[model samples]
Target: MWDYSDTVKEHFFNPKNARAMDDADAIGDVGSIQCGDALRLTLKVNAESEVIEDAAFQTFGCGSAIASSSVLTEMIKGKTLDEALKVTNQDIASELDGLPPEKMHCSVMGREALQAAVANYRGEVWKDDHEEGALICKCFAVDAVMIEDTVRANNLRTVEDVTNYTKAGGGCSACHEGIEEILTRVLAETGEAFNARASRQKLHASKEKPPVPGKGMSNLERIKRIERVIEMVRPQLQRDRGDVTLVDVDGDTVFINLVGACSGCQMASLTISGIQQQMMEDLGEFVRVVPVPANHAATTGVTA
Candidate 1:
């Protein structure tokens, strides 16, 4: 069973503003019941001051979802619409002490609802269909823009991190590749390295063994695990304004391309040796880390 925080349980058992406001000045609706989560937020704004006088929510989801929506209403109660727009999903999670990573998507839902509500009040066109970006996760109706924004907002690294925060790859695993592509682009753009250990510590804290490697592992699984290991060593490389990108993995051989300062550094061999040692330790297998030329075209796999 998932552990529920005390504040989360309190709101779940007795949620505030759980009713519909007949005199609401604006209403924001998001999510789909077909996707197993939906939320409707109502607000009563003072026309002259543009401050939210009242707020309420009616949500169809798990306890965390209800609590998130319930708490969001309270958070926005006396704040102006502009002020309330600044509230992020992280703030909602922080307000409730903390939520299980799996339930973090509930907080994201609440943040979207708030945005929708504010947009409605301002006569803007905002809908859950997410027409701005291509739909990446058909099961959850998550779009590329949503995934990219969440990744930037939370500094997400792995597909698992995106799944936890946005529910993009949580359903059918088909969108995993799309999510990874987005992560790579966003992290590269910001020059931010993925912290694989920190993002996944909670989930693996109790596991004694790392996943078995190189047995019947599929190509995608190998790439994912390889990328994780690269992310683990990326910070060290990034410290010197250098980075490594996973180009391809053929059997036990991993192809990588060094970029920036490490591209032609004298210590590139030592860095590759360190990465090889780390990969062997983490993957529980002997592997070769080969550096490709800077302009090498990768046939398959993802950059870390």
Candidate 2:
């Protein structure tokens, strides 16, 4: 279980500024179907010119969402249009004292909803330059640059999926909501543009890695690489019923697979003891045999 800070617990239980404005001049709403977090922001802006008169929010998710929304409402109240636009997820996180790495996205989302709502109020549009060739999240179809900017700006989601896919955390596990922020921004900009973004990510994933020049090595030279091939190939061998995952490495080690009938076959122990043991022994002391399994484990009977 994660340790909830006192501030987090307090805000979770008693989130401030938790309501919807009856006479809101502008409104913004964001939701994530996968993570199950949603927020609605309302603003009362000064007419004649775009200035914020008041702000409020309603959120549905964890304590982080509630606290973020509550704090965001307090932060933007009485601020002018320009000043309120500057309010970011990081500011909300700071106002709450601080949030956990994962919950940072909640604060960040509140800020975006505010921005979207404010933009809706005015006739202005945020036309990003890299909208065409942006790298969306590989997982969630979030734009890369937008996610990066959102993470830096809001200090939200740190998980890799969130960062790359949604602008929460794409590169690593700590920032996910950042990915969601990017998704939200993109969806707001072009609600039906998800298809293009997803296709781009797929294209990137299917591309083969180009061979590096001058880095090529022969099979014999490469087999001598590293200390443990046994552990690496265990699962691969298991897939072929202990047939062959790793082939004979120059009569030293024989590569075998453990799959089909041999994966969970009752004769697995017999195969290991008879054929595997005899092959390794016949190969001599310096000779090593590598067996690759299908699922996880692999075995290499060698040290050097």
Highest TM-score among the candidates is held by which one?
Answer: 1
- Taken over the whole model, the C-alpha lDDT of each candidate is 0.82, 0.57
Off by over 4 Å in 1: 127-304
Candidate 2 C-alpha lDDT tens digits along 1-304: 5466667677778887778689988888776656588888898888866667788788889888887887777778888878888886667776787676546667768877877787777755633233212434332234566565554555432243332223222233333343444545555554433233553474365343232222354555445441244454455444432443444454444555555545554445444444443333332233334445444232344444
Worst 10 residues of 1 by lDDT: 202-211
**TM match of model 1 to true structure:** 0.47
Cα lDDT tens digits, model 1, 44-83, are 9999998999999999999999999999999999999999
RMSD after Cα superposition, model 1: 16.8
